[model samples]
Target: MKEIRFENVCKSYGKTEVVKNLNLTIKEGERLILLGPSGCGKSTTLRMIAGLEDITSGSLYMGDKRVNELPSGKRNVGMVFQNYALYPHMNVIQNITYGLKVQKFPKDEINLRTDAALGMLQLKGYENRLPKDLSGGQRQRVALARAVVKQSDYFLLDEPLSNLDAQLRVSARKELVKIHELYKQTFVYVTHDQVEAMTVGDRIALMYQGHLQMVDTPENVYNRPANIFTAKFIGSPPMNVIDMAFDNSNDSAYLAGQEIPLQEEWRNYIRQTGVKELAFGIRPEHITLSKTQLKNGLKGFVKYVENHGSSYGVYIDLEGNEIIAMSESNKWPPKEAIYVEPRLDKMHVFDKQTTNSIGYPTSIR
Candidate 1:
């Protein structure tokens, strides 16, 4: 395995820059994911690392060696694409050993490596089966097996599970994790699925509009997002960001007509930054519903409810704004009137103008 580094890397098509100046480092044997929506330049970044695209500026490194000029075949990287990309007439064994055959390895060595890959991927008895004969999940395993048999220093996976059904994707995720654990190789995966990035990656790089937003573990990104774009993009159903104005006329700040007690450090930060407008944010799971209003909260009407089998989502209208909360209990509040109090410690505060988190300091857990 090798450490991968990108220093101020960029890509452009004619005059429009697809990937802006980006810098990142992926540790050896680490599982890193690039996550964002379409046109966010994630795939372009992956292609650059795989030597399939030219870097418009900056440098790329594998460990200490600068590889910005290396060709794809000479980079010693294995890539698995969204489509299987298998030869139509080739069977599993042929597909797995094709690289070795082209390299002119001994026939016995080819058999040995192919057999090991087949066994590792749980394709032990399907060597002769053609690609058309295999299921989607099985074909995916074959793709992985081929990458494994190549003995590459790094693995690049670009939406490898997007072609599979939901159930198969779930199962395949576990399998991919196991394969990473067994092989102990540096893996860089790209996908738009936040769930996949959260569950699969050791560290995630969140991007938007060709810019790198933040890079951290799943828990850190979810609990203490660096900016508003991350908090709005990383979670399902998203975080509730209520518009609020900080009243600086008094000695302390007030949010929604309620006094906000700032931590000693945060008070200093606000004073230094000269922040005036703030947004109060919280996740759905951190809210509790009641029939009466609390001293520091709001009373709202339940607009609708969604039953997701494991839990219920109660959407409420607070004043004129909408907020959604997740409930563990099957019993729900009345649809007409209800109150919600967000757990104070679980709340987030962001600059209303810049949209960057400013409430609490966090460390990776």
Candidate 2:
């Protein structure tokens, strides 16, 4: 396995810049995932690393060797594409052995690698089956076995599970994780599904508008987003962002004219943002509800209920605005009156102007 590095990498199409001055490093044996919506350049980055796309500028290195000038074959990288690019006529064993044969390896070496890969992918008995005869997930495994036979130091998976059904995708994901664990190769995966990234990746690079927003662990990305875009993108139902104004003299923050006591950490973040008009954020899970109005919480009317099995999504209408909250219990409160309270410690404060998080200070812990 080898470390992959992108130094000020830039990719352009005529006048439009699709990837801009990206600097990232994938350490040896790390499972790194690039996540973003289509047109965000996540796939482009993966293709560039695989040497499928030419680097417009800057350098890319695998371990200590510069690979930008090398072709895909010379880059010592294995890639599994979204479509499971397997030969339709070739059986699984043929596809897996094709790479080793081309490399002119000894017959014994070819058999050794192919057998090991097929066994790891749990395709030991289906080696004689053609791609057309195999299930979608099995075909994908055949494609993966082909790549593994190459025995490259780096692996690039570009939405490798996108073609499979949801149930098959789950099984395929588990197999892929097992492969990664067994091989311990440097893995770079690209996908638009945040759930896939969160579950399978060791670290996630959250991208947007052709730029890297944040590279962090799943927990950090969800709990402490770098910006508003990330804050809304990572969560299931997402955080509720409302316009909040702070009164410095009163040492209080107002959410829809309700005076809520600001914790010292939040107060510090407010001072750091230095803006009067800030956005207050709270996750759906962080908000609690009751049939009767509480003393410290805010009052709002129940707008709607969505049953999501084992939990209920409650939307509250406060002053013509909708604030959504999730409750583990599906029991509904009265439509006319429902009190909602936010756990202040779980709140997030961001700068209104820059849209960046002004996080709570460490001393407040």
Candidate 3:
């Protein structure tokens, strides 16, 4: 296993810069996920690490050795793409051992590697089957098996599970996690899927507009987002952000026309920071909804309801701003107006102008 570090790394094509001043250190044997929307330069950053794209400036290191000029083959990194990328003409065994054979590995060593990969990825029974004969999931496993047999120091995956069905993708994610645990190789995965990033990554590197937004553990990225973008991007239904005003003289905050209750610590922070206008945010799961009005709760009319398996998302419109709250009961479109109350400890406060988090000085929990 080798640690990968980027020091002021930048990538561009002519005049357009896709990656800008990236400085990140990926620990050895850690699964780091590059997560963001399209055109955010995640795949481009991965390509640069794999030596598929040249770094426009700065340096990239693989455990102390600078690899800015290294070829992809010499980098000893295994890669799997979204499109399977398996040879349709070759059988499973042949496909898995192709790289080893090209590297002129000994017959016994090749057999040993292939057999281990096949067993690890549960593809032993389909060794003789061609790519055309296998299912989509099986084909994906074969692609993974091929990469595993290489036994490279770094494993780079670019949306490898994107093509699989929902159920298959879940299983594949588990298998990938298990493979990483067993192999202990440095993994750099790229995807726009938030679920995948939250599930499979040890640390998530969120990027936007060629800039690194935040790099932290999945839990941290979700619970203690650095800014409004991080908070909004990481959640499922996304966080509900509402513009609010704070009165320093009374040490009170109000949303729309209703007063918002804040914990003592939060009130103190806001008073010390002297912030007047703020963007208050809370996750849907953290907000509780009630048919009857609750004390110190914001009331809104039910706009719609979205069923999510066991839970229902109740969308409520308070004034002109919309907020969603998760409900366990099957209350589809409440006849009466609903009341929404965000947990005082769970509320996030961001600067209205800068859109940066100022809720808690440190991460909550």
Which residue pairs does candidate 1 place in steric collision? none
Please provide, for model 2 over 28-100, each residue's C-alpha lDDT reduced to its tens digit, 9 standing for 90 to 100. 9989999998999999999999989999999998999889888988888889999988888889999889877
Candidate-wise lDDT, in order: 0.84, 0.87, 0.91
Question: Whole-model lDDT, candidate 3?
Answer: 0.91
Highest lDDT: which candidate? 3
Name the top TM-score candidate.
Answer: 3
Give lDDT: candidate 1, residue 216.
96
lDDT tens per residue, model 3, 1-365: 39999999999999999999999999999999999999999999999989999999999999889999999999989999989899989999999999999999999999998888888889878999999999999999999999988889999999999999999999999999998998999999999999999999999999999999999999999998889999999998899999978888787889878998777678888888876678998899998887788887888888888898988888889988988888898675654588888987888889978888875855344
Which has the better TM-score: candidate 1, or candidate 2?
2
Q: What local lDDT does model 2 show for residue 243?
A: 78
Residues 85-177 of candidate 1 have per-residue lDDT tens digits of 988799988988888898898999888877877887799889899999999989999998888887788999999999999998998889789
- Return whichever of 1 and 2 wins on lDDT: 2
- Give TM per candidate: 0.92, 0.95, 0.96
Off by over 4 Å in 1: 251-272, 329-335, 359-365
- What order do candidates take by lDDT, descending? 3, 2, 1
